[model samples]
Target: MRHLRSLTRTLHKQRIEGVTFHFDPHHQHELSTAVRHFFTTPEQHTPLDTPEATRGVFLLEGERKWVLKHNRLIHWKKQLQNYLGLKKAFGLHDLTNEFINLSAVSAKSACAPSVAAFGYKGRFPFLKEEYLLVGFLDDHCSVDDRLIAHPEQASTLLPQVFDLFARMLDEGFVHMDPHPKNILIAPDGQLRLIDFECCAHSVIDHDFSLGFLMGYFFHYWIKRFIAMDDYRTCCENYLKVEQPTLDRSIFMPVFERFLTGKVSRTTRYAILTSPKAQAAFKAQ
Candidate 1:
């Protein structure tokens, strides 16, 4: 139960040419070597395939598993945002934001991975790359994989998903990307959320509207791999856990919008036509 607040309070900070490096006091001994190896000889580490370019590499030392997330800071879209001052508004650096969010979320729950260390390699307004080291969770499977493997477990697992969302909401937090791939299902059936790159904190009265839930379901389940019946069951189960009186009518518009979006249109067509997607949706 190493809390982020305590860790940050004891963190060792070093500044070089506007680049700031934060190291966990406990792991300072291994920090330099680990950072060197992470950047110079990445091939020595095991590559992890992530949807985004900020992929991770696993570094094993004795029995410890450290995941080094290499996040590139200079991208065309980010550059445009920087010019528009949007980067400053949202702390647009992905790794920095992820580290901050992870620290905040870890303060609330044990769902987020424990951050070991984080640093930016270059100066602001022209920052190069950023990196974050975190402890890896073993024996965990993505929620998407679990749902596809055991669709029958939806009735049992959907409650856990709802509970996690409820806890996050109660804590005044919201995961901008609520995709199944970002959620890990532990062997003991606990739900652990990962990838805080897009997470945000909100006011206590933040809206958890049916529209938001519908869009979440569409992006995480329906557009990917889920049967119509199971999708309905998920919605119903979520309502059972959150608001029993609210019906599905309020969410239909969100679903309709999801279907009409360009990305959703292409994804829906692909899923409908692909044999693999069809098979996964029909999985039991």
Candidate 2:
């Protein structure tokens, strides 16, 4: 039944006002052919996500790639989970709001992929998906990727990672998810953040609470990314004279203990399923 539904599924593209594209060469018309191909050539798509009835694929644009993030109905198991209160309900994916949030956080610490084109598919209430096309960023890679290739790089990158999170908090922005894969190291050494689906920015971002941000990003970063020996350096970078937000006596021990209690991000990212990535992980 689901297969039949998929075979006949129709997409209804929508246009929203005030939305902009990062690609300058009229990305909409330019992407039309590629978008059509994406729907038609299912076998060619390099699967980027899990078991999903809705599609998510890499759309090509000449030399570059873009992410076609489609939001569609959840599976019956997921629906059952929601009904049983065993999991949170999956919400709608609104590309327009995501773009606005991206714009707000640009240049602060990280960035979302520049949206090339986006819209809704099918009717709204159900059996519909809202999607956006964003460029597959080049000249950079995720922090986790960098670490997997060179575990030794952890020492240097971990401190910069902490600083980036701290900078975001200072600049009135709070990212709900700054996980290793979501944080990228740009070519110029600037950190770029992706995945703004759960992120936010505000004039008074502190309403989200700096303490929670610290717990969410900083200490969590330690357990996931920073090694035990590197904790002091990250703490120092974050609590230097210019930014005297937390007391040394309070912050250092907490971070050290956090490091002690959990595996660093470097260790966790060291293991990979891909032979190439695993070989790189071993090479370092």
Candidate 3:
């Protein structure tokens, strides 16, 4: 059976070159203990990225560039464990395919290399997933770093980012992680979107086009975070430019029309089941 095969793979920790794989459900605890010891006194220092709600990402480089994602200290073995734990989880759209799939969907979509996934060895408890043999980005700094250094540039860059957002929504994918840090611009000045760990598909009408999505996102981003020096005046201008006498609730019909026509079954199922979506939809 597939479960038996998974178990067998779990028992034997396989390593190819510098990459180590841990998918064992049984030996997770033992493997975690050993890994912690090894990592604590690593032959090469392991750099820690910022902490996230779900996991801690680490930067590793020796033979190659890699981003290692360690457990969040509490959870089931895999990253998808939380999503799978929720009701109608199986019916939810699979974001695991999004990283690779984005390339085909859009030329602007860029992502960090995903070389491997690890869990645990033998019958231990605790899961660790390591990404190995990744290719480096041209300019390694994240958008957050860039913005922190050049706040004035926010006006220019944020617009381009909103464009990216619109395109993804029009294309029927909702990039759940839109933080500035997740986007990277190559040396060639081409934009790339990275980190698909929380990506999901949404219902968007085919006719909606990337432009609509981008414009909306740009406004939303500006409203939520970015505050240009002229922000107060600009916001007043925006209100005047796009004046709407109708109540906000009137937009629900418009949103549903697009969602029902454009979104896939998988996305629809996820939207219906997810608590996040439930609240948003209810409010709408």
Per-model TM-score, in order, reads 0.71, 0.62, 0.53
Among residues 3 or more apart in sequence or in different chains, the pairs in candidate 1 whose N, CA or C atoms overlap within 3 Å are: none
Cα RMSD of all models vs. native, in order, equals: 9.4, 11.8, 9.4
Q: Which ranking of candidates, highest lDDT first?
A: 1, 2, 3
Error of 2 at 254 (Å): 10
> Which lDDT tens digits does candidate 1 get at residues 122-202?
433444666687877888998888878976676666667767766667676666566687789898988888877765554
lDDT digits (tens) for residues 141-180 of candidate 3: 6666777787677666755564555456555565544557
| Model 1 clashes, total count | 0
- Per-prediction tally of clashes: 0, 5, 17
What TM-score does structure 3 among the candidates reach? Answer: 0.53
lDDT of each: 0.60, 0.51, 0.44
Candidate 1 residue spans exceeding 4 A from truth:
1-10, 14-20, 50-63, 75-86, 89-93, 203-211, 220-224, 245-284
Give the distance in Å from residue 190's predicted Cα in candidate 3 to where it truly belongs.
1.9
